[model samples]
Target: MNPGASQEPAQPTPGKHARHPKAGSISQPLLFAASTYALGQVANFLFQLRLLYLLGPSQYGETGLAHLLLVTLIFLADLGYSSLFLRESGNSPDWQHTWRYALGHRLAATTVLLAASALGWQLWGSEGASQEYLLWAAPACLLALFNYSSPMIAEGRRLAGLLVTQVAWPAALLFWYLLQDSLAQSMAATAGLSVSLGYLVQALVNVFCSRQLKLWLPLVGKGQIGAAVHLSLIGICGTLHDRLTPFLLAPLAPTFLPFFLILNHVLSGLSGIQAQLARLLLPTANTAPGQARILTVASLLLWGTATVLLAGLLIKDLALFTGQRPWLGLAAIVIFAWGISASSGVLATLLISARLEGRLMRLLVIGMTDSALLQIGAAWAGDAGYLLWARMAGVLAILVWQLKLLKLRFGLAGLTTLALSLLACVADATDWAMTIGTVLLLPILIGLLRQAPCYLPARRAGAHP
Candidate 1:
């Protein structure tokens, strides 16, 4: 036998086949992360509720707008290429320049942000409503910048600072909350102090970690600047969703703003959980067997279920909707969020693993273009619903384009999920009725079949593999 074919097992008896040696699997990290994320969600909700109840709607709206602007500014400052840098480094540990280059852009951008903030303060000097909370705002910016570096650690060692800071920030804020006269001042003061302190704690810890890694920060040379710019460009796309929020919300009715901001805050925290999973998998798939594909498939189903179920439960709930029902538009948003998850495989993990920026960047450009067009659509529609519709359309465009790049196929489950989500968005239905219908329909279409033949193991007789 040829040497390459020599490893074949001796001829087997009829109706039997040689067993292929299988890869080992352990799922401790997945369990740990899922549990941690679930717990974190509970804590985060409780914490925010405390603030919302204390501050009331008006102050809450003001602070919420400030918070949105803060997030958008932070996202823009990141310059869109951080994701590419992170995925690059994780995909190849030997790409030693990745961190140095990425950090440089972040530091430079952060410095610019600080200067701009200071100039605003100097020029306006509390003329607007933002001044009352100025004390709380400055530190928040620094904290956001510092928190960005935690991804470096998360990728490198699965060491992340957010969890620790998550607990600490709230505790610190709660401490501040105890001291004030009314809810607004308390919230404002606590927000400022807690943000600064939280960032201080995280940055200090990260500095210590760098020392442990023996990172020679001083050695980054002039050559690294070009690399930083390239990486920064990539970062810009990855963060555009966040950057767009302030702009989208700014032109809308101010009364409805706080609710939308609160809604975004909840979604953001939920997505943060997903973000951590994405970060973990993008790095580990290089060494771990079968992770990339498994995660891709799981993402489609998990997010599909989550999006549909959440929309169904909240669609009729009087509390979640601040004004008129935009049931159809919200449903579209739900579907888009799910579709985006399926599409993430290409925009994120696959591109990272392959270390090919050209394809990813080209794809991102197309997606970003649609994003802009949808924003115009949202503008024309003239409400939160319009923006949601625009976003839904944009993400679906991303889904189709991304799938084309990978030449991947989705089964009946994914297609059905997408279809149902569209219907839910376009038509109004009672929450309970929709839930029962989906629960019955989803399992029959997706769960019972349990087929992923292209990637998963072959089924044994009647049982799904």
Candidate 2:
């Protein structure tokens, strides 16, 4: 037996509510993940700026299209297996078995999907520039297979895997761009090469980290494959819903795609706080519902504040970069949408951790279907502003459904403060409006903070109490 095995607590038997590592125990990992996410976003933002300067909008749009295609393929290949893996292995004793099972399933699915995509491209392919861009970009699908599995294991372990894998990829790409003096090269070729190489580096780092953590790949069982496929289908649908607007705009309004992509990237960066909090809470969502609830609310408030500040500071730069004033409205919508979605995301994580993914998946399918339909209708109008509003409407619909679920599970009382906070933020878009709203909402925010301790788990005897 490993020397550390005896010193460590024995893994609890998998149950409806599995035991989770304490928050204090994983504090460092959580910090690292958050820091890495923030840093990665900054690096990505700089890289985008550099690309804009070097390639200009038209060339950058081509690169964006290629990247989107690669991302779509990767998402389709994922099939929700990583999340399923994380859930199942949360407290499993056999680390090797679990890691191997998840990795094998992921690899198999990715391989099949990538092969199909390639075959389809060959059978009915585009010509000239579009073809060349896609041809170079296609290799990213293969690298993605390796890039993905490492993070899954890291997340399952609740370690700093994302910090190493996610951050490294972007940093590597930036380095490559600088090294190549990419301004003179074909933008498509440079982007494709940089991305593929970055993922390769990420894959290597992930493998090293997994090994250090003592996770090894093993044989997969037949039963695992069925579950992975089912989960993946739901995941694919969810991704398609999120990507629907861009997908529609790409062909119909190619000019708008680049601006939309940049806006989306910025919004996603703002949403990183929620992502970090979600990761921190995933383990405890089931085991310590009260503490998770408290953290989720706190995270929402913090994210809201950051969004307002960041949006205010970056609004002009954003407009200047995108060369569109309408981007201001889009940015506001994205901020509100992210705020709402973040709250919903917390509840979704709680549900999933509680082994309620089946129910969650069903709700997701319904919500995403509605969202896709709405976005399609909006795209048909051929206005970027209308399309963004439509996307926000879809996000709002999902947010409402998620809130309804939360109310059902935890009651409306705890969420009342959150609702008010969200309302305050919605009204805080402008300086005068924000001043008035903040004055009115100050009491509520203070009261919630004062009562925060009541939301956390009670102290144990002979412990910190």
Candidate 3:
């Protein structure tokens, strides 16, 4: 750890709904984490570019499906409990107890995953050499418990340990990938190895950092464990919120998998900006609602704009980038774009701050059910864009219902999101007039954002909240 590096802490606010100024609370450790996460993201994005060049479409589709399954399995392995560590870690000063519990839980998870993998192998590993590779991924997933705790450790800016995991693990994978000659195993194997190795380093680093920081998890009763499990359950829903897209596309069309995956990646990458801002803002929302709202709205607007720009600029070449049959249908892309933009991660984090985390997952379950139904319906319809429409419709329903649940009284501002969703659809079908109408209306809508407490103001010198 860099002992000389300045480290600042984020104190949990005293008030129920207020927070200290976020700009100051967003200390070096958090900044480093946010930057590293983004860099790792971009690197993975570049890695996908390489994957497209090498894997082409069909295999890309297969790879995407496999990845989705892995993610889903990871979800199952954790039983939605890792996030408890994150939230709890943020408030707890010493993490000796937290580490003890986390280590115990992770070990249990790892054991279960190992047994399940063994059983799965006996039952179906012989499906194909390709599938055997999938079965082989179990060990890596089991070992990935380390990364799960990185967020927890980074809560107070003790980020050096997490940094080692983030930086060193990928480097290790890149080295091994170059050394490996088998093209077939390169992508999947490298990913599995990278994640496991990375998390291993991360876990080790967390141990050292916790020791150096003199942090210890507080000893707690079974009741705390239960509460942690409850929050972690809701938090797992947040993870699945991003993890299930490829699974939806898998049975629909193998060729469309990579294309849809690319679209999902773009949507996710853009939304991550929102999530990053949310992390910075949520801790402060308890002290400075107005300020946090400013930051939130700005984040939403930036991501929303980038989403539009990416659509206008890359819609044509997006398929070419995938090397697979570019699943055509700008309308589908529009639906996807608008859906993601409308459901910003900032909003999700805000919900968490509001103690509405369960509802977020509750809403997500509804959307997932709707998405799944749409998947089934699309399969029956034998169409290309049906899933897109399904997603659009389901997400719109979710937004509308969530809006109602949130009791958002921003009459016109809420309508603006709906109107934008419609305009994205209009842009899809060459309805330029409608699209432009929405675009022209954007500024007026932007102004209305001030009415909502979702955005926060930028910090200035000598700022105090």
Q: What TM-score, over all chains together, does every model reach?
A: 0.72, 0.72, 0.70
lDDT tens readout by residue for model 1, 1-465? 121121211111111111211231225665365345545455445645655676776666655655555555666665444454454434556444555555556557776876776576556343334444555656656555443344454455444533543443454455455555445454566565654564566556666644535332423445335433444554466566544644575567555555566666666665656655554555554443434334343444434553554455444445655354544345446445644544463235544444444556667777877787777677767876677666767766766666555444444445655665555554444546456444545553454244322222222356322
- Candidate 2 achieves a global lDDT of 0.56
RMSD to the true structure for each prediction, in A, is 8.1, 8.0, 8.4
* lDDT, candidate 3, 41-105, per-residue tens: 56556655555666677666655555455545655555444444545544556455555565556
Stretches > 4 Å off in candidate 2: 1-32, 88-98, 116-133, 147-159, 178-185, 212-223, 229-234, 250-256, 270-273, 289-323, 408-465
Between candidates 2 and 3, which one is better according to TM-score? Answer: 2
- Cα deviation of 303 in candidate 1 (Å)? 5.1
> What range of 10 consecutive residues in model 3 has the weakest lDDT sum?
9-18
lDDT of each: 0.51, 0.56, 0.49
User: What TM-score number comes out for model 3?
Assistant: 0.70
> What is candidate 2's lDDT per residue for 206-279, written digit by digit as tens?
66765544443436665456556655665666567766667676666576567777876776675565556565
